[model samples]
Target: MTCRLPAALALLILPALPAGAQSLEDSAARLAELLRAGRAVISENQALINDPGLGDKGLTPEAFLSQVTAAFLARTGSPAVSEDLPPFQRALAEAQLEAMGQTIAEAQPLINMEGVGFKGFIPAVFARLANERFGELADGRAAVKITAPPELVRNRKARPDDWERAVIEDRFLSAGWTRGEAYAEETGPGFRMLIPEYYSESCLACHGSPAGETDVTGFPKEGKAAGDLGGAISITLRP
Candidate 1:
């Protein structure tokens, strides 16, 4: 739908973290905010495609994602980032770009199915598909994993990693923090990053109670309640 934020909102929302010379916390927060914002934009665009009025106006998911990718690239000014940037920061930006590109590519097939309509699918499905594909690419060089506590996972891929396991057990699941947390710490020669994700009402159909029930895609439900510590998205960067 060619979603464009108001100029004022754009100014406030699109700031990219400086490519170099920032604290780990600042860098992590910036990356988290950027990724979250990108996700929000994609979700909003998907909704527009489902809007009858917008659909009739020729808004398609592919077109909407393409525009979003372009806007994000422009906002990041990534081309200007020096090749000498810290390995973690550079890889972070690269992964973010790869993620957006993969979303646009992976969504094309689904977008083509617009003729049949996306009746059984939710926006998060597309997001997960894209992230999983990116996770494959991240192996060895960097890492991206989405996982919840063991009880909340429907499959092995969603099982918590060591860092996520600790965070969920010590913080969200135990300490009751509803908000996302971000931190970067040394891992071998580089660092690993983590961001928490909480369950919302939209997640109920798939992850909420009645444990053995199947969701729209027929995947087993996790019987989780709203606001539960659904999972975290973890990333690792290496030199």
Candidate 2:
């Protein structure tokens, strides 16, 4: 299913900004929305891999994700700036778009490696490799990670980091939020972050089941429901 940000949640997440920074905030919010949209497209398309028509096409999940990203960007007129924005806002928008593109590029290979079958060891091993390569491409300016809570994935990397644990605990675990998107400034200067991810029907194959059952990958299942939070795609930015 396509995910839509609730209006109330959107309003709550918008940062309070000074008049001078309002334009920049708007630009940032727009970029975050785009990132969320891109993720949703990937999720929905990935879920379709099992369809008779789509399955016969023989495209791997990663390849399908890349195709969807390209089509979404093209349809949305991405990399285009509003002419009315001031020079600074225009520049900020352009930079954010570039970073988003680079992040997608780096993520695609990892998703490709995981494939569609949720097979043994491939997902876990390639997920680590993807994170390593993404770290190299991010080059200290930003970081991206895909993780689930300890109860779900049972891997060290699946555990949320200090920056993320509280949010996951409160918003996802406590409140039953299946999907979320947010942007926040870090304690340090010029550092901010955006996170967007959600659960989907296909996630149930591995994550949903008897708690101790072995999945296709021989990993213990989480006994999660269809709408349970599968994991997150978190992107931290230095800009």
Candidate 3:
């Protein structure tokens, strides 16, 4: 599920912007580049896992997460996140962990599913990028999204908040999306994207079941669709 941080909540947590800082659009562009890079890395890892000969050693999912997590740490040059994730993503990540754990431990078993998943980790990667770019970590419902006219995915938009909304609409008038710095601002510069089933399938294991639907701590329970793309991560900007 896509995590969304409302604009109002961001101001309460994000640090003040620096003088002569980049406009929210510029900062968001740079952040999107980082997010794309991270996504590429995750995609590459998934490809490696599915490679024909890589499984000769019989690697376990735990081993895969260990190696991949280590590579992520080494690549980013950040401290380990053993005790807990940075404050901004703690609640979000923890909830994900619980849901994922429950899926891996029970749901999958009852349903006879196999193969550990990966794409679902975008939120974590987004958090990492937000931390590096903004010097602040956003937690559950806190995140950033890149947006633009579909024709101008390359041409940056001055309306940063609009782009955040674009992500939820999944109608980036532009070519594609990138990542952005997670922050806060007056009127809450950015907006949040609601997660619906359309964006992911793993989300169903825990979120689809009636018992898990309304009770998931960090997720929304109503007006969501089977394939509905969730809300965007809102961030306040200097511009």
Candidate 4:
């Protein structure tokens, strides 16, 4: 299940842009979507991954990617990447996939450890590691990160930067801000994209409940309910 590809073999597949900056926007959104797709796989298999009785959880990076691919296709009606895309965009997708794979590979020991429940390979941690690897693979060409409001940030690295904070405070949190709408801009020499993420029923397991009560992850819950603004996925693409 993938989007229809350009049929003309000789054509370099580039997304049609109504404006000059749309390619970067599209590429950034694609990378973010793929990253979250991987996170969804991890989220879906939390039980199996955390089962102390089950060694070799069978969710190898390759297997995980296959699931992620299917999830992405189902979510967006597009393949994570295609031979039809132009070299740069294709390279970004490949790097993101490789980054996620490497992250899962590195966590084998923790993921497969016997008698260890809740190995801390949660989706947030997985995304952080994967994004770090993607930055290295992109060699400064692009970067992806998960950031949240200052009070809700559990990890310092996941804390919003100056631009990210502004967007979060001024746009995503505003009463008039459209739910699930993404904000993008060409800021300075790079393109920046900020996609708002909402708290889901599953997210409540760790992020919801009585305010200040500790969750399973040992972090105090923010008492966020479903549909609340949980965070955002920020992407940067440099020329």
Candidate 5:
């Protein structure tokens, strides 16, 4: 039931609703409720992934993904997308996202902002997920090597059958958001989901600035000017 929604989105959701679709206050309230449930979906699964007891009990990744995803499906009332996933892969993604969440949470102490908005975390979270799941993060030069097809990254306005930009703008650079068979394309063959993090002042310190005043643990400094990247997350799926 742990849904990871960017705080900025909470503000954006209201205006975007269909014209005269429903009462704004009521619609916002409902969205908030559903989002709360979605967040719980992530949180609960993360706990399961981390529980040594579950692992010790011979709970395999497949077994866990099935159990946890079922829980999420039930809570959010979303279609059971996990059935399309190999149980092992599903569990791996769940665990990876959990770990990424932890990394962002840890960075909280270093942050000096009102709240860590979600838009900024896309790259870091994607980096963390790639490292945990794919091994060796792919953000800078490495990402260019694993480039997303031009069709996918370009055409910012087109909403294809599969794949969507993490944000409309190019500034929030999380390469993992657009690359990978699992996330970038949907040929009815694999997994896909955009797990965006809320922006934190700490994130702005790096992504926001062209010349980051401070250096992340692994990345070196470049330039300054990028400013608070506090905005979006969109994912694609296959039926």
Candidate 6:
């Protein structure tokens, strides 16, 4: 029910929806956007989190949620929790936000630690943790996750399953597929959607060149360039 989402993809996660798309996809996509926004806020404050001179960076759940809202608005040109959302959609969105808030609040001590150059609070890690909380909060009604190609995976828990792997390799990574497009369909389980993410300039610092060389989190770089198929945000809604 929980999985990993890639780091540094705030700018490239959402894709334009097709006309008359299913409401399920819309709701799932919006939840994915919110999760990405949370990651974006965390990425922007990496310096503060790693500041050895600071004891309290002041990124409480409320403060962080405000930043996440602003980030979502700036990126998507829409309010994160729009008033017009259906009751179900709004409920699920709020649950996702609540999950994120709880996750960050619980990490307050670690994030504000002194003399720590890198607390390893990167966007990917935050996304993964938040998603874990989301699964529990959502109570099996929905789930969100980020995962990547097999060779690019660092956490075994983040490994994409057969469904995600097939979509990533046969669709998202296909040269003919449209860039930034999301793929969705209902099959074996529940309704599922995956928004493709590319390696942006920001992602290069950790996921970029000098293949096999260790990056900040001690993972080898994927040597990927900007615009390469880096990962996907996977969403599932129960039937």
User: Which candidate's lDDT is highest?
Assistant: 4
Q: Encode model 6's per-residue lDDT on 36-97: one tens digit a residue.
A: 89998998998889888999999999999999999988988988776676655766777777
**Candidate 6 collision pairs:** 4-146, 5-146
The candidate 4 region of ten consecutive residues with least summed lDDT is 5-14
* lDDT for 135 (candidate 3): 28
Task: State the lDDT of candidate 5 residue by residue for 1-239, as single tens digits.
Answer: 25633322222231232233123222222222333333344344443333433323233334434554555457657533344443322322333334334444443332223322222323333333333322222111011111222232222332323233433233235544443112222224322333223434544444445543454433433332323223233322211
Candidate number with the higher TM-score (1 or 3): 1
In the range 1-239, model 4's lDDT, one tens digit per residue, is 25543222111243333345777877888888898899989999988899999889888989998999899899889888787765567767778888888899989989999999988889999999999998887767788999999999999999999999999999999999999999998898578999999999988988998989998888999999999999999998774
RMSD of each: 8.6, 10.0, 13.5, 5.2, 15.8, 7.5
Candidate 6 residue spans exceeding 4 A from truth: 1-21
When summed lDDT is taken over every stretch of 10 residues in candidate 2, the lowest stretch is: 1-10
Q: For candidate 1, write residues 1-239 as lDDT tens digits.
A: 14643322332334343444244554454455445545666666655444433224233444554555555556665431236655445455555555656665655545445445434435455556655655454444444556678776765766777766886787766655556656457766456677778889977877887988887667888888887777776765443
Which is the winner by TM-score between candidate 4 and candidate 6? 4
Candidate 2 local distance difference test against the native: 0.50
Task: Give the TM-score of each candidate.
Answer: 0.65, 0.54, 0.32, 0.90, 0.26, 0.89
lDDT of 3 by residue, 1-239 (tens): 25545433443454543433343333443333334334444455544434443323233335434444455466655422333333323333332222222322332232222344332333333334333333233332334444322321221331234544544345422235332223323344342232211335544543344532552334433333344333333333332
Superposed Cα RMSD, model 3: 13.5
The per-model lDDT (C-alpha) reads 0.57, 0.50, 0.36, 0.85, 0.33, 0.82
How many angstroms is residue 39 displaced in model 5 relative to the true structure, after the best TM-score fit? 12
Clashing pairs in 4: none
* Model 6 TM-score on a 0 to 1 scale: 0.89
